[model samples]
Each structure stands twice: as C-alpha cells, then as structure tokens.
Target: MQLFTGLALGSVFVLLAVGLSLIFGLLTVVNFAHGAFYMLGAYAGVFFIGYLGNFWLTLAVVPFAVGAVGLGVERWLVRPLYGRGIDYPLMLTFGLAYILVEVVRILFGAEGMPFDAPDALMGAVNIGVGYFPAYRLFVIAATAVLVIAIWLFLEKTSYGLVIRAGARDSEIVRVLGIDISQVWLLVFGLGTAVAGLAGVLSAPMRSVFPDMGTTVLVEAFVVTVVGGMGSLAGAVVAGLLVGIVVSMTSLFAPAMAEVSMFALMALVLLVRPQGLFGKKGLMG
Candidate 1:
C-alpha cells in the first residue's frame, strides 16, 4: 500500500517534470512560470467545477484554458524576446511567475482552498497489505495513459519527429521548410496543457493554495535534473524514485525529506552532470 501510494504521488512529479523537460529541451526556455501555470490550472479547475459541478469537464477544460494562455505567451511574450540571450527568457519567466503567484494570493488568499474529489472516485481499494485511495489510483492510471500516449506522440508520430528534429537544430529545421514557429507554439501549448492537467489532478489531493506550485516546481526541477534534463524516461524513473525516497525517509526524518532531493541531485551531478538518460550534446 505504501509503495503504491508512493508511486501514485510520484506520478504527479513525472507529469510535471515532463512538461518542464519538454519546454527546456526544445526552446531552452527555463520557464520559471511553469509552476504558476500549474497553479492556474488548479484554480481554473476549481472554478469550472464550482460553476459546472463536473470534475471530468473541468479536467478537460482546464488544460485547454491553460494551453490557450500558453499559446498567447508564446506569441506575444516569448517570441519577441527570442533574439535576446537565454538570460532574458529566464528573467522574464521568473518575473511572470512572481507576478502570477501574487495575483493568485490577492484573489484567492494565502490559505489552501478545498476541491472535492469526484464522487465516483471517492473510496479506497485494497491493493494488498492495505487500502489505497481510489482517487490516487486514478492519478496513477491517468499518468500512465498519458505517458504511453506521449511516448507514441514523440516516437511514432510525424509531429514528434519534427519536434525532435527541431530540438536538435531549430535553424536547420526551419531551413528545411518546416514552420518551426508553429512547432514552437504547439510544443509550448502541449507543455502548458500537461502542467495544467497536473494541477487539476492535484486539486483533490492537495488543497489549492497560492504557493502550492512553488515547492512543487522546485521538486520537479530536481526530478528532471536527476533523470537527465529533457529525458522523458528519466523523468518517470526519477519521479518514482524520489517519491519513494521522500516517503521512506519521512518515516524516520521528516524534516530531511525536502533536502534529500538536493543531496541526491548533488550526487547525480558529481557522476553525470547531464542527467541519467540525457544525451551527450542535448544541452549544447
């Protein structure tokens, strides 16, 4: 039961890290606003459910809403600044993240707000030694489905090939007559949608709070780094590994659970600065 719960919790990290990895992998956008996007998704889900009283609807709608916002950011904010140094994107996103969080605090208050679990998934299921929350199981299942789906999208599909090619060399892809600009928009939207999905999935598990994504963003970066930046498989493996480590360690040293990731990250960097499954020149 504990193991299952651990994996379930880690799955959220997997989802988040993938989006982060993708955004950075393709655009080198070091999106500090990533967490803000997640928080927005949760808040959007909360709002949707409150008005429509449908979890599934909110699940579908929240991602689209967030994705739309991402599209706008890509066009108006990120695109114009592309000619600038990477520092520009980093600083802009950091500022955006701060402003977004402050707006959330002002509108929603600093306290965590409640989000009801869908009645259909409100119980527990006995997995083996004990019972696990069915809702968490849904999170696990949903993420698994997403992983497989994304794997296919990136591995077996034409769009995925173009994205990968663009990741390798954006200028070359554009020279080859591909509209790399549209691809950038698509990838950014996809990343935001995934982050949004993470937020919606998280709402029932953790109350929606202004800073809910702050810690989560930091942890997602750790998971991405330990897995190897921009490596999807690495994200999945590291997410679960970190979750298990945190859970088991919290049993004895609760206060140290937070710092364990930093320690692990340092150890990993000493051995492999690029990450577990990262390619040799991906960051270059």
Candidate 2:
C-alpha cells in the first residue's frame, strides 16, 4: 500500500518534472515559474469545477488555459530574452514565479483548501491483498496514459519530429528553412500543459493551496536532475525511484524522506552528471 501510495505521488512528479525537462531540453529555458503555472492550473480547476461541475471538462479546460498562458508568456516575456545570456531567461522566470506566488497569496490565504475527489473516483479498490484508493489508482493510470500520449506525440508526429530535430541542432533546424521558433513556442506550450495536467491530477492527493507548488517545485527539480535535466524517460524512472525511496524511508526515518531525494541527486551527480539517458555535457 505504501508503495502504491508512493507511485501515486510519483506520477505527479513525472507529469510535472518531464514538462520542466522538455521545455529546458528544447528551448533552453529554465522557467522557474513552471511550478507557479502548475499552481495556477489547480486554481483554474477549482474555479472551473465550480461552473462546469465536470471533472473531465476541468481536466481538459485547465490544460488549455495554462497552455495559452504559456504561449502568452513565451511570446511576451520570454521571447525578448532569447539569444541573450541564459541569466536573462533565468531572472525573468524567477521574477515571474515570485509575482505569481504573491498574487495567489493575495487572493487566497496561506491555509490550504480541500479539493474533493470526483464522484467516480471516490472509493477504494482491492489490488491483490491490499486496498488502494481508487482515486490514487486513477491518478496512476491517467498519468501513464498522458505520458504515453506525449511520448507518442514526441516520437511519432511530424511536429514532434521537427521538435526532435530542433533539439538535436537548432542551427541545422534553422538552416532547414523551418521556423524552429514556432516549434519552440509549441513545445513550450506543450510543456506548460503537462504542468497544468499535473496540477489537476494532484489536486485530489494534496491540498489545493495557492503556494502548494512551492514545495513541489523542489521535489520536481530533484526528479528533473536525477532523471537528467532534459531527458523525459530519465524523469519518469527517477520520479518512480524517488517516490519509492521516499515512501519506504519515511516509514523508518521521516526526516530523511525529502533528504533522500537530495542524496540521490548528489550520488547521481557524482557518478553520472548528465543523468540517466542524458547526453554528456547537456547542462553545459
């Protein structure tokens, strides 16, 4: 059951961490505010369900909303920073994160709010000899489905092929006479959409606080680093690994739970700095 629970939480990490990785992978953008975008998606879901009363609709609407936001941010905020020093994007995103968090805090208090499980997902199921929250199972299944879909998009679709080509060599992609800039915007939106989906999926598992993403950002970053900064598959494996490690360790030494992630990052960095599945010198 604990392992199941860990996997459940881990799925959220994978959903979000991969988005962080992909955007960074393609556009070389460090989007410190990506977690804030996740937080915004939860708030969007909270308000959306109020009007729509449809879990499925909220799931669909929230991602689109955040994706639109990402597009806007890229167009207005990040676009200017392009071709500049990396610090330009880093500083811009860091400021954006602070601004978003402050705005959320102003609108909602510091206390956490509850987000109910959808009626269809509000029960427990017996998995073998143990009982698991049906909502948790749903989370796991849904995350897996979304991941595979995105993977397929990245691997199969023409758009994905171009994005991959751009990732391999932006200069060559540019020489190919395709506007890789448009592809960059699309990938950024897709990455942001993933973060938004993670928020809605995580709403049932954790409190829907305005600042809820703050803590998650740290854990998600750990997953991103451990999985390799820009490697989607690495993030997935590292997410599950971190979840299981945290869960099992929490049973005996609670304080070490979060520490375990840092420990893993340190060990991985010492051994394979580029991360599993990551090309060498990627962080360069």
Candidate 3:
C-alpha cells in the first residue's frame, strides 16, 4: 500500500518534472513559474467543476487555459530576454512566481480550499496487500496514458522532429526556414500545460491553496537534479525513486521523509554528478 502510494505521488512529480525538463531543453529557460501555473490549474479545475459539474471536462479544459496564459507569458515576457544571459530570465521567472502566488492569495485568501474526488473515484480498491484509494490508481493510470501519449508525440510526429532538432541547434533549424520562435512559444506552452494538468489531477489529493505550489516546486527541482537536468527519461526515473524513498521513510521515520530525498540527491551528486540519465556537459 505504501509503495503504491509512493508511485502515485511520484507520477505527479513525473508530470511536473518532465514539463520543467522539456522547457529547459528546448527554450533554455528555468521556469520558476511552472509551479504557479500548476496552482492556477487547480483553481481553474475548481471553477470548471463548480460550473460544468464534470471532472473529465475540467481535466481536459484547464490545461489549455493555463497553456494559453503560458503562451502569452513566453511571447511577451520571456521572449525579450533571449540573448541577455541566463540570469535575466531566471530572475524574471522567479519574480513572476512570487507575483502569481501573491495574486492568487489576494483573490482566494490564504486558507486552503477543500476539493473532493468525484463520486466514482471515492472508494478504495483491494489490491491484495490492502485497500487503497481508487482515485490514486486512477491517477496512476491517467498519468501513464498521458506520459505515453507525450512520448509518442515527441517520437513519431513531424513536429516532434522539429522540436528535437531545434533543441539540438535552434540556429540551424532557423537557417532551414523554420520559425524557431514559434517553436519556443509552443514548447513553453506545452510545458506549462502539462504542469497545469498535474495540478488538476493532484487537487483532490490535498488542500488547494495559493502557496501549495512551493513545496511541489522544490520537490520537482530535486527530481530534475537527481534525474539529470533537461533529461525527460531521467525525470521519470528519478521521480519514482524519490517518491518511493520518501514514502517508505515516512513509515519508519516520518521526520526523515523530506531529508531522505535531499540526502539521496547529495549522494547521487557525489557518485554520479551527471545524474541517472544526464549527459555530461548539459548543465541545463
């Protein structure tokens, strides 16, 4: 049961980490506002659920809404900082994150909001060891499908080819007459959209609050570091590893749950600084 719980939590990390990795890989930007986008998605999900009365519709629509916001941010804010060194964009995103969180707090107040799982997902399922929340299993399955779809889109489509090539050499792609700027916008939007989707999926598992994204942001960073920065495969593997470690530790030593991930990160850095799937020299 504990292991299952860890996997479910790790699945959420996978969604967020992959989005971060993709944006870094393609746009060369460290999006500190990614978690803020996630929080917004959760709030959007709440609104959609209240208005539409359908969980599935909320899942499908909230991501695009957040993605649209990301598109505008990338076009207006991030685009200007293209050649002005990395610090500029990093600081911009960091400040944007704070602004987003504060705005949400002002709009919704500091108290966490309650969101219940759909009636269809409210019960527990017996899986030999014990009964577990069916909603968690649903999360695991849904995330798996989404991840697989993303992998296919990145592997089999012409757009994916362009994205891969652009990631490798945007200048060369531009020389080939591709509008690399548009690609950058799309990639940023896609990354934030994924983050939003993760937020919506995670809403029922915990209270929704303006500051909820902070801890998840920190954990996603650890996952990125452990999995190797800008490595999608690394993020997936490291997310599960970190999730299981934290969950198991909580059973034996609850106080060490958070520390264990950092300890593992430190150990991994000492032994294999490049991370589990990271390539040498690709710091981003």
Candidate 4:
C-alpha cells in the first residue's frame, strides 16, 4: 500500500516536473511560477466543478484557462526578458510566483479548501496486497497515459521536431524560417497547462491552499535536479524514485521522509554532478 501510494504521489511529481523540464529545455527559463499556475488550477477546478457539475469537464477547462494566462505572462512578462541575463527571467518568475500566491490568498483567504473526488472514484480496489483507493490507481494510470502521449507527441509531430530542434539550436531553426518566438509562447503555455493539469489532479488528494505550491515547487526542483534539468525521461524516473523513498521512509521514520529526497539528490550530485540523464554542457 505504501509503495502504491508513493507511485501515485510520484505521478503527480512527474506531471509538474515534465512541464518544468519542457519550458527549461525550450526557453532556457527557470519558471518558479509553475507552482503558482498549479495552485490556480486546483482552485479553478473547485470553481469549475461547482459551475459545470462535472469533474472531467473541470479537468479539461482549468488547464486551458491557466495556460491562456501563461500565454499572456509569457508574451508580456517573460518574452521581454529574453536575451537579457538568465537571472532576470529567473527573478521575474520568482516574483511572479509570490504575486500569484498573494492574489490567490486575497481571493480565497488563507484557509485551505477541500476538494473531493467524484462518486465514481471514491472507493478502493483490491490489488493482491490489499485494497487501495481507486482514485490513486486512476492517477497512476492516467499519468502513464499522459506521459506516453506526451512522448509520442514530442517524438512524432512536426511541432515536436521543432521543439526538439529549438532546444538544440534555436538560431538554426530561425534560419530555417521557423518562428522561434511563437514556439516559445506555445511551449510556455503548454508547460503551464501541464502544471495546471497536475494541480487539478492533486486537489482531491490534498488541501488546496496558497502555500501548497511551495512544497511541491521545492520537490519539483529536487526532481529536476535528480532526474536531469531538461530530461523528461529523467523526471519520470526520478519522480517515482523520490516518491518511493519518501513514502517508504515514512513507514519507519516519519521525520526523515521529507529529508530523504534531498539526501538522495546530494548523493546523485556528488557522483553524476550533471544528473543521471543530464548531458554535459546543458547545465544551465
């Protein structure tokens, strides 16, 4: 059960980490505001679930809404910072994160909100060891499907090819007549949309609060570092590894569960330095 729970938790981390990886890979921007986008998604799910009266619809709508906001932020705020030093965008996103959190607090108050799973996903299922929440199993399965789809999209589509090429050399892509700027906007939006998706998926599992993003943001960073800064495969593998370590550690030592990920990260850095899947010279 603990292992299963860890995998489920890791799936959430994979969603957030992959989005972060995508943006960093394409734009070379460290978007601290990704977590804020996630928090907003959770809150949006609450509003949409009530308004639309369907969990599935909430899942579909909230990401697009948040992604649209991400597009504006990229167009006006992030796009302007391009060609400046990396620190400028990093600081901008950090400040944006704070601003988003404060705005949400003002609107929703400091209290944590409750989000419940739909009736269809409220129960548990037997799986050899014991019964586990059906929703968690759904999360695992859904994350796998989404990850596979993302992989296919990145591997098979023209846009995916552009994104891959852009990551390698945007100058050459531009010389080939591709509008790198528009791609940046789309990638940023897509990354934030992924974060929003993770947020809605996570809402029912935890309290929806302004500060909730802080912890997840930290974990996502750890995952990014451990997995490789811009490697989607690394993010997926490291997310599950970190999730399992944290979950299993809680069984024996609750105090150490939180620290286990950091410990593992330090170990990985000491050995690999560039991360398990991170390529040399890509450390930015």
RMSD of every candidate to native, in Å, equals 1.4, 1.3, 1.0, 0.9
Order by TM-score, highest first = 4, 3, 2, 1
- Stretch of 10 with least lDDT, candidate 3: 275-284
**Model 3 Cα lDDT, one tens digit per residue, 159-257:** 999999999998999999999999999999999999999999999996699988989999998999999988888988998899899999999999999
Off by over 4 Å in 2: none
Task: Give the alpha-carbon lDDT of every model.
Answer: 0.88, 0.88, 0.91, 0.92
Candidate 3 achieves a global lDDT of 0.91
Question: TM-score of every model?
Answer: 0.96, 0.96, 0.98, 0.98
For candidate 1, give the lDDT of residue 94: 86
Cα lDDT tens digits for candidate 1, 19-114: 988888888888888998999999999889988898998898998999998999888989888868778888988888899899988887888889
Alpha-carbon error at 142 in model 2, in Å?
0.8
Candidate 3, position 147, lDDT: 83
Candidate 2 local accuracy as lDDT? 0.88
**What is the C-alpha RMSD, rounded to one decimal, of candidate 4?**
0.9
Candidate 4: which stretches are off by over 4 Å?
A: none
